[model samples]
Target: MLTQEDNTLLTRTGPGTAMGALFRRFWQPVALSRELPEPDGPPMRLKILGEDLRAFRSTDGTVGLVSPRCPHRGADLFYGRNERNGIRCVYHGWKFGTDGRCQELPTMDSGPAREKAEQNVRLNAYPTREANGFIWSYLGPPGQVPPFPELEFTTVPPSHTYVSKKLQQCNWAQACEGGLDTAHFSFLHMALDDGEDATAKLLTKVSSNTDTVRWMRNDGAPRFTILDHAAGLILGAARRGDPNENYWRISQFLMPNHGLTPNAFPGENYHGQCWVPIDDVSCWIYNYTWNPDRPLSNAERDRFANGSGIHAEVDAHYIPIRRRENEYLLDRNKQKYETYTGIDGVSEQDACIQDSQGLIADRTTEHLGPTDMGIIRFRRLILDSAKALAAGDPPRALNHPAAYKVRGGGAVAPATQSLPEVLQARFGT
Candidate 1:
């Protein structure tokens, strides 16, 4: 549990806050590439870290993330025209390029005064890069933009990767804690013991094998071992398997807000998520799945599109169909007789529980246990970094972006093997 002071420092991430300052140092995903599918397309309104912004794709395929207010008369830029490599305010024909440079001021006459105004007038713009189907923006100070972290999904070919986003109605920290806390899988994503046939069917949907499901269900209290690396931490949860085997579900927590799931085995697809704060009370969970070795099949792509694995069944606006307003379409009968949560999808089930923790979880009043070691370590890492930044020292993870190139998944190791041995054998580090 945290003190009230620590909880506030961790949860609140609006501009000028300690946590927000730390987040701005890293590039964040602002929107999916498909949001602005064409050049000179419609501008989209975006709010990240509690600041309202606008995003539009220019004629040359460059994405502009700029302040929404037009400087000329404070008109909302969302109503502007996106054309000819810039956004032109419809009210006064004042145009700004992707770099935020004023391109034209039609209201002014052509003279030295107009030239001076165009040279001095500018809009706040952040640098943007498109990769792995997402448009990422740097919101930090000028000339301090760090290199993009080499996330596996972004490094892979388009044919081998799939990405999607869903709105999570809660503080970003708790939703992120949900991803790092692998111990919850034993109960939160399990099936009721009605019969062997029913258990097998439900297990198939949750895991790659029934044996793994049995191991998770039988051993709810998995022993945890956390290893810190340059980029982040490796969280290993070991549960009892067969006579001499240990079922290790290893997940990765990278820097600020990324978590790689532990469901994959050798030759299987890998999954991950990035929890970006939309505000103090809400967030956007960006989900990605990739197969590094081969192209994903059409069937797999269709399944993901229809909400499989970490991806949610989102509507046209990327809002989960089963959300807080509808009580996640909960079914008490299914909860008692079928699955553990009676939730139709894994993503929905996760969102349901995380949001239930209140808009922002009150860690000060909660009790924690050994199973929460990963969560504890996560808080320490982020809190320490935020504090260090306040002391004029930036996080080391920001400087070592290449160190982010790590994998997280499952491995059946000998019960005697230590966490280091298991990681070495599985990832071959």
Candidate 2:
């Protein structure tokens, strides 16, 4: 049970809070680097972690994240004038370079005296790195930024990836859980199966987690009694729900933020989920679909963009807002199922199920069951790990160079198979 202090810590968003500080330690994906055109405008406005910031890309394509407000009399830097290598405030014409150093002051005489003053002033800036088509911003101490995870899939050519964003009106935790909860796919997606004969088998397979149950925990926070490989079949949904024996699939959750579901077909058509936190009440879900060889036609893109593709069939579940009798039913249903669903299938297909939870699901009033083992353990992990980080004694990254194959192993193979197969076949699967 969580104490009053723990409960308060969970809800608060401050530097001292466990969650806030833990999140800062990570290099968060702020924006897509491609969003900034090479010859784009001077200063761009970006919002992350509930704070508005001013950013600019150098002519060389380097990005700089800095305080949105100018230091000299506090003008909006977003409106600043853009030069080749720096931005000049529109109000007072004070120029700041990519390094946050004041390069020029239009009002001051151009001489040694002006240079001396400019050298002493520097704008606040966060470290920025561009990788995997995204701009990651490190908000933690300069010395502690962890090495960015090497995502093998993202290493493919630029033409292989298609990206989109889903605006979610919920907390980051809610968005994160949408990916973490594996059991919802069986029911939430059952609507599609109910509507058409073609989808029934696929839906059944997705919902079926009848095999394999293992209890585990990470970071000393929560216990994870997961029904692994349950989500493997759902990856078929992206490829017209193919059930061929030769085909394979996987659903992987990269702890703390993203979800990856990959298809093992002739043409690699992969889907990913990125959770973007925007304060306590809202977040953004960034979706990416990567097809190595088969490029989606404009029509196909439109189908997804217009929500008429597989997304439509999957979204048909959930009660309409006006017809909902109880607001909490959906969340309770989710939490109840997530505890031991035997499989973690996609859950963000519908808003009704999540929105009906009334923003934050209250754990105090809910009943516990053996099946809820997964969610309970997961929550404990977050709470415990977050508390640890909140204290000065920070934990080490789970990546172990010696243990290699067991955890943080860099091997690329189907995750559905057992350890023996993983060892014997290695990359054969």
Candidate 3:
């Protein structure tokens, strides 16, 4: 368990906080690219790392993420007219370009004074890029921006991916830790068929085979092995399988906040999620599924779009239909007969439990065991990085962009094998 001080330090990520500074060093997803829809469309108001910002696409499809408060007279840019490549403040004819440069100071006289004002007045803006289906923004120090990490999902063809986002009503860290804690699958995502063959039909078929289901059902406390690398961590949870084999569920945790699910095997679809803070109390979970060798079928796309795997069935606003206030539409009968959660989707089951830990989990009171090794290591790595940044040392992951190109999934190995050997046999170095 963490001390209260460490717990507070771990959860609070607002501006001026060490944790927030660490987060700024990486590009963060603020919105899905499809949200803007077209060039010169509606400007989106967003809050990331506790700062209010606005985003708009220019005539050339360049997205501008700028402060929502217009520099002149402090008018809200949210009500601004998105026209001709800039947001024109409706309060005045004042306009700012996607780069945050003042385009027109029409309220002033067209002379030296107006020209000077246009050059000096500016709005806060962050560099943004579009990839996969996300609008990723860099909130770090200018002139020090690094290349975007080559997350495999972004490198794949658009046809090979399905992306969606849903609001998770809990702290980003807790929601993220939920993804890394694969041990929970034995109970949280477990169906009534512990010994039956029904649950063997893997939810997404990444971790398939009936023997795998029996292993998870029989072994609640999987032995944990953590491997640290340039990008972040490789978390392997090994459950007792038949005879002398170990069923390993391996997941990846990328620095700052990304998690690759351990459900996939070779030739199967892969899944991942990014937990971006909406604030200290809530976050947006961006979910994606990809097939490396081929384009996903229409039915697969429809399944993901309508809540399957990590994706949640969301309303028009991206808020999960079965969210915090509604108790996740939990049905008592389903809990008794169908599944342990009684929750509609895997994503919702995760949301329900994570949010139940409270808006911010009180880590100080928790009882952690060997099964929580991933969670413990995760906190240590991130907290250490945050503190190290405060002392003028940036994380090494920032420089090793290619190191992000790693996969995590299920691997069954002899019980005698070491973590590295298992990793090598499953995912070659």
Using TM-score as the measure, which candidate wins?
1
TM-score of each: 0.98, 0.70, 0.97
Q: Whole-model lDDT, candidate 3?
A: 0.90
**Tens digit per residue, CA lDDT, model 2, 392-416:** 7553432421211111111122435
Ordered from best to worst lDDT, the candidate numbers read 1, 3, 2
lDDT of 1: 0.92
Stretches > 4 Å off in candidate 1: 195-199, 202-206
Instruction: State, as a TM-score between 0 and 1, how close model 1 is to the true structure.
Output: 0.98
Off by over 4 Å in 2: 1-13, 110-113, 192-194, 198-250, 262-268, 291-303, 308-348, 368-371, 398-429
For candidate 1, lDDT tens digit of each residue in 1-429? 999999999999998999999999999999999999999999999999999999999999999999999999899999999999999999989999999999999999999999999999999999999998999999998999998999988998999999999999999999999999999888887777664565676555546677887888899999999999988999999999999999999999998999999878888898899999999999999988889999989988888889876889999999999999999999998898888898888899899999999999999988899999999999999999999998999999998888888788999999999999998899998
Worst 10 residues of 2 by lDDT: 211-220
In the predicted model 1, the residue pairs found to clash are: none
Q: lDDT score of model 2?
A: 0.52
Q: What total of clashing residue pairs does each candidate reach?
A: 0, 10, 1
> If the candidates were sorted by their TM-score against the true structure, best first, what order would they fall in?
1, 3, 2
